[model samples]
Target: MALAHRILTIRRDPHSGEVLARGGDPEAHSLLERSGFVPVVRRHETYHRLPTGLDQDEEIRLATRAVARLQTVGYDLDTDPVFATERREPHYLSLGDQVRHLAVRIREAESTEEVADALTELTATHDGILAALTKVLHTAADFLQDLGHPADPHTAARLRHLADERLHVLASDLRHVRNDLADRQAVHPHRAPCPQEVAGDEREKSASCPCPAPARIPTTPSAPAAAPPAPAGRRR
Candidate 1:
């Protein structure tokens, strides 16, 4: 079995010589910082490699981060070399399972900080899945547009539709969760206020404090829709 590793890259600008790009997990960010690669204007881009692991939920999260990072650089599951050799089963968590876990975390979160963290994790998962699916559609479209249209046009079109539907589901789910979090944060004011504010208060008020402002959600022109089930036995 091949070793599982996380990789990130930094690209340099062709003219004027400067750090053009940088991305990856927190560790990668730290590495770039330690190496003196300050962010600068960019003219070129490239990918680099690094080797990394975790367990269960953490493994799934790491995989998601890897996918999101690659998608940022125009690579996807079909092209990322690490994915080709890496053992995926151990890290694979179904979308249903992920949603359940996030829901549980949000429900059990006791403090504002905890809720914020859970919301952040949920948002990241949504982003990672959406990025992967978007790339799938792009790749399919590009393939169908090529000369002779080597691939079956019907199949490519179906795949693109499925990806788009999945993306719609992902976005809808995320928006609902964000709205819920915002609502909860507004009314369920159980925690104490910030320390700095407490120190400044002469009365040491025990009033219900408001949570941080929730993430902004844009209104869609069309009404919301759910992802329809694919044919029997074919999972989304």
Candidate 2:
């Protein structure tokens, strides 16, 4: 998803000097212009840095504030129900489950090495989810731009396409990461086996053991290269 350009337009108060607001849509500038105001060309506002370590309540609060501000400007900034009702709620629930699982593993860990490994995996998974969410937010911004209610249609369409492509790739990566973590948990219910299990005479030399192994199973193979088609002839 493309990063949105934060447009800074100059506005003047009755008694104060010039002030700037982060302008998005053209209609806003148009309204100001029609009301006997002039738009001054200046440097655009830098993008606001996102807050880190924000809990779900903080996130909802921030989002609600933004929506409220937009509402005052006659813009309808509704939260996507799919994220709230379906994807995000479930995703967070699953994340909580994973955290609980990791906590249990940490508590039941036999050694410091086992606890460290589990914590590392949990941290990596948490980071992966954060990156996925960032991608989703960026995609949403691009999607909003593409609605063309306040932006140029051509530019919006291009941004929309790019956003769609990016979202697809991010979603695919997220799915792969989730699946890998799930597979790892299923195979390695606990920490690695002790030396006794490895040295046991009853231990089979089978390749398909339901335990974490040095090697991973190949999911799929690459397809053969396809030949390019001939160029089409021009019609008379």
Candidate 3:
């Protein structure tokens, strides 16, 4: 989906005024040109920065508040995926944080395009996590089965239970994101391309050339991938 509003994160050093992170779409660039937010342009867009001597935390807080103000006035600001912090390092991201990020993006998305983007991101992330969790459950279940007469049976059981619970929660999140995407798509479906019109505006080109109509692909639901079977001794 093409972003209609260009939202970008403006990261700069607190004292040097050096740009730490700066990137925005053309639409956002245009909007910024007309808005009161004055960005200092240096060598190029990459060097554009808002000089401030405030602390990093204070800078981020002010930036977020500025974004919030724009959002209230119907401006779609790109902050998610890079909100405040540049990266969460994945290793430290909890399951709850993952879900919360998706929920916040979905809630803040003001257009069908943004919603679709959010849904796609959520689906990909959720599926990977779900698969990993399922693998953990399967591995733990098998281990428990192999150590039929071993000590510390409770440890394996707890692992399996935790994986199962997390998987269920992730699945629910997947469903919610899918629903949100469907609703947004229904409300603002993509406009089909008019081949002839798109081909050319000149009379001569329209008469001499021909373009094939784009094919419509049919969508069908397939059976969900089966989770690895629990060990024979355990309940699925």
Candidate 4:
């Protein structure tokens, strides 16, 4: 039910005069973030706002682009006049979506070796995703450490700590697990790779060839309604 009804409102706050966008699905939120809006994640709901200190024209451009992109993906937007646009900008896949395919591969794999191969793509030392993420964190930390803001130094330190400690441990553990899986050459008992071809003795061509359906639990059938009672006056 989570992204069932995608709707949003883009307008300047009545009191603060800051451009704000609220009430959207995750896809709409991602579009706003790509369009240069900052997300304000609250306990119950999340919303986006134009980052502070932008010129009015720049703010309008970002807001209008967000509206266009969200609308292009079929979101219903209630927008202010300045933020409304007739444009329906073409959408592109985000980098995060591309990276998520690794998880899909692992899920669909029928053997430990296949899973290990997918994990190698993530834990590979040279250009793996974790390596790239470590670089991004360090790059951000270096930029923020000397920004002259009082809180920025601590924020940068937190990022450095995460990259140096938590992420390193995770990558190391995953590397170990991947190596172990790579050594195992057995297929999963509950899963097998389908050949995607019909066997010579197959009876029904339209039915599943070699793949078997997942086992299902038996459900109790409801009792049939009792037959209507015979008319007592006529029969008895």
Q: Which structure among the candidates has the greatest TM-score?
A: 4
Which RMSD does model 3 reach against the true structure? 29.9
What is the C-alpha lDDT profile of model 1 across 126-227, one tens digit per residue? Answer: 465456557768697668755465566766777777767867687668757765665665533454444433334556477443455557899768976888
Query: How do all the candidates rank in terms of lDDT, highest first?
Result: 4, 3, 1, 2
Q: What is the C-alpha lDDT of each candidate?
A: 0.50, 0.46, 0.54, 0.88
- TM-score: which is higher, 2 or 4? 4
Write down the TM-score of every candidate.
0.29, 0.24, 0.27, 0.78
Sliding window of 10 residues with minimal summed lDDT for model 3? 82-91
Q: Per-residue lDDT of 1-236 in model 3, one digit per residue for the tens?
A: 25543345554556965433345554344333333235556775442343346565654654554454445444454453323333212123446567669778767655665666666654555465466667778797778866866654777777777767867687678757766766755433233333454344665743642446568898898999999987778558
> Higher TM-score: candidate 1 or 3?
1
How many clashes in each candidate? 2, 0, 1, 0
Among these predictions, the greatest lDDT belongs to: 4
Clash pairs (backbone) in predicted model 2: none
lDDT string for model 2 (1-236, tens) is 11232232232223632222345465434433433334566486321211445554554444444433434445432243311211111112335466668778867766555555565553344464444555555666666665757655656566555546765576566556545554553323355463433434545676244444556777888898898999999999
RMSD of each: 28.1, 24.9, 29.9, 9.4
**What is the per-residue lDDT of model 4 for residues 107-176, given as tens digits with 9 covering 90 to 100?**
8889999999999988999999898889899999999999999999999999999999999999999999
